[model samples]
Target chain A: MSVLLSPERVEIQLGERSYPILIGNGLLGEPRHFDAAPAAASALIVSNTTVAPLYARALRDTLAGRFQAVHMLELPDGEAHKDWQTLNLIFDALLRHGCDRKTVLFALGGGVVGDMVGFAAASYMRGVPFVQVPTTLLAQVDSSVGGKTAINHPLGKNMIGAFYQPRLVMCDLATLSTLPARELSAGLAEIIKYGPIYDMAFFDWIEANIDALMARDPAALAHAVRRSCEIKAAVVGQDERETGLRAILNFGHTFGHAIESGLGYGEWLHGEAVGCGMVLAARLSQRLGGVDEAFVQRLSALVERAGLPVVAPALGLERYLELMRIDKKSEAGEIRFVVIDQPGSAAMRSAPDTMVREVLAQGCAS
Target chain B: MSVLLSPERVEIQLGERSYPILIGNGLLGEPRHFDAAPAAASALIVSNTTVAPLYARALRDTLAGRFQAVHMLELPDGEAHKDWQTLNLIFDALLRHGCDRKTVLFALGGGVVGDMVGFAAASYMRGVPFVQVPTTLLAQVDSSVGGKTAINHPLGKNMIGAFYQPRLVMCDLATLSTLPARELSAGLAEIIKYGPIYDMAFFDWIEANIDALMARDPAALAHAVRRSCEIKAAVVGQDERETGLRAILNFGHTFGHAIESGLGYGEWLHGEAVGCGMVLAARLSQRLGGVDEAFVQRLSALVERAGLPVVAPALGLERYLELMRIDKKSEAGEIRFVVIDQPGSAAMRSAPDTMVREVLAQGCAS
Candidate 1:
């Protein structure tokens, strides 16, 4: 059966300027996928040491046929290396291989690779064209869709970056077959985010089919990836730079980033951090009169079902408080959280330390 | 005579997405001036050790009254120091002072400080609201307005950064009063860039008043800053990410960056390197049929008039070609130059090394 997907392309209308994010299957090998990118120049593929082994050859094999040349720059995997020292690999490869402003950089890995490649494209001789070909479910569903490109610093995660949207985001569901089960679970936390922040019904659907998703069912995964991209594209299209509506998309990120920063990088996957963070935010929401006990329980059950860490790791209350205050969402050192009154509805709000501490203590109870 | 000569504020209209460029006198002390920046929950001011002592106090004193509270982070001075290690200083300062996403950052210094501070602000917790309080001429007129914030790398210049915009760009012409004459001349290189790429009228104005500008005449300086900012704002507003029209803004940058990269940072001022680069670009432009001997003579005359180097530094022609190819702008190691077809019109083009060598050789003749 030769099925046709609408490509469900969303244009991030920046007026006389805009870009598309394409979501579907078997996209990597398709020539039509990159027609929007600059055709007169070379294309650079920046993938991780891991992802390159699986998909780089096919991507290069595809682009090399049409473009003047195709080259690959393999970066070491993990969040620890997503800093200046490691990002230079792309530059070193670009220089060694000879890529220019017209050179289109394809980020063919997960969040680490996509963010690094995106930022590299953003600052490479001021900026260059980049396309997102996210392999991991987490990146396909979130990081690759938005224009937010950045690198992690020692003091914080994603501490250096820019709001540079890709020329196109090609999300091929077929790639997820190779993702680790733990990573697949981690990606769900963000997918679950869309349903709660904007579509309560979508959350309920995931609630019912959590088992099928855990098995990496293609139909289920495609639906989740396509819908998540739809929601993200819609939010980002309207508020591309998170000045307003897009902030809601960070439903659990304010809390999630705190946990990630508090524990240090690599100890927990980004999704794992958000999974635990959502629990605390749910509790805080209940106290603030934004969300009730039933809502908290509903979300927690989903977190647990997704095979994510539902309970916060035991870092002392002071450290938790200190870390949360250092969050990008904090103002004047005041801790902020993107809280939900109910599924599909969210708000960015500030909370006092006393309430946050109580939620932290409750989060550790499990 | 209480003559209030506003530095002709230019409105860079991107609709509801538009921002103002404040080009005038003693704006730091004016209470309303700080209001140009939206009231954020928190704010951080990123300045250099040198600029901080001179102006950070006034900035903090002003922003403290507006933002939730002001946090100050001081970094070292000079291009050599504007790297990840220096950027870590801002991140460390933010974490130590407990800044969050709601915090707005104010970049209070020249290009080195502005680029690093803007980069720190962009990467701090993914992204944050930043204001550009540019002190030097190069920054006040060019880097400060374009949202092209970055730092030089061990391998290349601006290899790490983002196309992150500032909420407001406050160019206090008074700050230039303290800029050393050599530094002032360095900035004039960028001032000369506008005349050739997009504004011949401004170029002629610079040619006419070279002496007053060299003397750091406030009126002449303010005029240059305002006109340059307007040209930059128009270009950036049309092409915020250097996709097309914005590339023209890099007229002298390709050659300038190679010199900076070859000699290593801080050996010569960025404007000085650019001053030299513009001369080489002019010669290259003449070779490629984009410019005439008359245009080259005008550029050389201006560089000489500004008391800046009008020839490529003796870093070896082979080294120059190799370094230029590794720049963020180079693709597949093929160097691209933003050459003028005529004064006020520029384009990114490729040329032969044989021709470039002739230009390199011309530098030796001098």
Candidate 2:
């Protein structure tokens, strides 16, 4: 069965590893999501408890029609469960079920589920084919699109991971209907990010259409996802390994990740942390003369209006610094921040401890 | 200081991931071995307890001259310890040392150390540069050059892994002098493999120089390693991902992995298992009419002469079948064996269960 909405497709070109991102409503029912996926003898659907009951059966049925055997592995939901122990569950299930390298894995959940499954597939049999059926807004626009598969370490976010590309990314917007309002707001943080980092026009659109998106208007959600993925696809196509250009896509992530790790992962939703992170990043950018105070305020106002935190969490200046220094972007002991040069532009740069502290103090309630 | 024999370099070209394999004695002390390595702030020499006391100090001294921080993570030696827990030690040390992505890891042991360190580099910060200073004949000739890094699972050997290539592979013949005779014999199992699978001439050379290799002649070891790496480099360059041509390189691995898993990892050194596995594969080839029994007997004689197990352990047919089916090469429960079409040639094809059973019955002592 095909979805009603004409699926907007964005191709992430990395030569032989290039894959298509299919964004559409009611895509769970669409058989075409499995079209580009390699015809495997068996398919394993990896979803969390929160997502399995809603979409696992339909996904299994769709996959079953194509594969000889379809197995569903339900993981405990939440970012805290995204570790090696939980990843082992997928490996255990795959091995028990006699799944081979040809066995395809379908990641059918939010960012946490997608990231864990992608990593599981990446390591299983030294790498296997996986299809990302992203159910949450955070996954569709960011994590699932970029091929950055990882499991978080206690010391850092996405510490143990791989640059494994997926065979196909199916973003079924219909699944977002079951999403909590908090999660929807969290996803908007990433959505709001593309505007300041790559395209100011898209930022303008997100500002104008925030309400419509919060309302879960299918058209608005589809357009936002499509545009965000397009920008991500373009950036990822240029730098799949995050050597240079890809760091810009992490516009607010350096600070965002610090906030996430400092407060403990899943304490704040990844997007929520990133949303707050964008505010701090904007302030830091302004302090560095990349942008003005007015621009920072404008972005902060939008983040707040999106129902995300405009103010940073009091993770403490030193603790945040400690966490940020360990971030993948940090070279030597110097912490690199992906600061916005201006609207529609961002680059990774290091700032002095005093200036970073000044922004943290100004942005946090403490 | 440079050694007596000039080091020969073999380049395994995989476009951007292409790296050098330096084969010579006393090369580890020479700084030229690391000339191509990315100049990093720190270097973590990931060796083991056995290798550490013997060579870590010298390697550390050599690396310390170049890198500001030269840290060593000494793990428990042996294949039994090559699991996620031991790998975590490397991760923990890197994090504790404030090692960043620029931190180059040196796998300074045999196959186990090289595989673990390479996998660590592959996962750490998504990807980092690693140098393989393989100290065993098996590793120097095969595992070190190909970039097939992995840790074993309870169900299979090398089950959990990644195809992460190293920046450089340094084979110091001096280290092999300390290798136990049994360990040396195990390495010869892999060295003898090159002839039957890829080069008949190399096979003839191995038959001719078996005594020279076993006697620990430096020139003999260097020549064997250089030729083995050349065959491996040619194979790996043609098929980096092991989709087609690379599978042939695992001429005996399908059966060999089963033997290792059945006997339990470390019970039989990897090369010993492969030596017996090559005999089984040869017998299977004869059964499939791919080769004559003479080829099987000839290979088995050489394996026995080299002090490797020519007869397989009685793992029982059912258990062997169970283990072999889960191998990465097996497709859809059809156990694909890399059979010798003739000496110096191999092809992956599935044999019938009955034929496989017969081969097992003939090969196993039971």
Q: Which prediction has the highest DockQ against the true structure?
A: 2
Interface RMSD of each: 2.9, 0.7
Name the regions of candidate 2 deviating beyond 4 angstroms. Answer: A1-4, B1-3
Highest-scoring model, TM-score: 2
For this target, which candidate reaches the highest lDDT against the unseen true structure? Answer: 2
What lDDT does candidate 2 reach at residue B129? Answer: 97
What's the true lDDT of residue A200 in model 2? 94
TM-score of chain B of each: 0.96, 0.98
Q: Candidate 2 on B1-366: residue-level lDDT in tens?
A: 236567788999999999998888888887767897889999899999999999998898888778999998899999999898999899999999999999999999999999999999999999999999988888888889888999987777787889999999999999998999998998999888888888999999889999988998888888899898999999999999899999988988889999999988989999999999999999999988877978888899999999999889999999999999999888889899998887788899999999999999999987
Task: Encode model 2's per-residue lDDT on A168-237: one tens digit a residue.
Answer: 9998888998999999999999999999999999989998999999999888998899999999999999
Model 1's i-RMS, to one decimal, reads 2.9
| Residue A195, model 2, lDDT | 94
User: Chain A of candidate 2: what's the TM-score?
Assistant: 0.98
Give the Cα error of residue B35 in candidate 2, in Å.
0.5
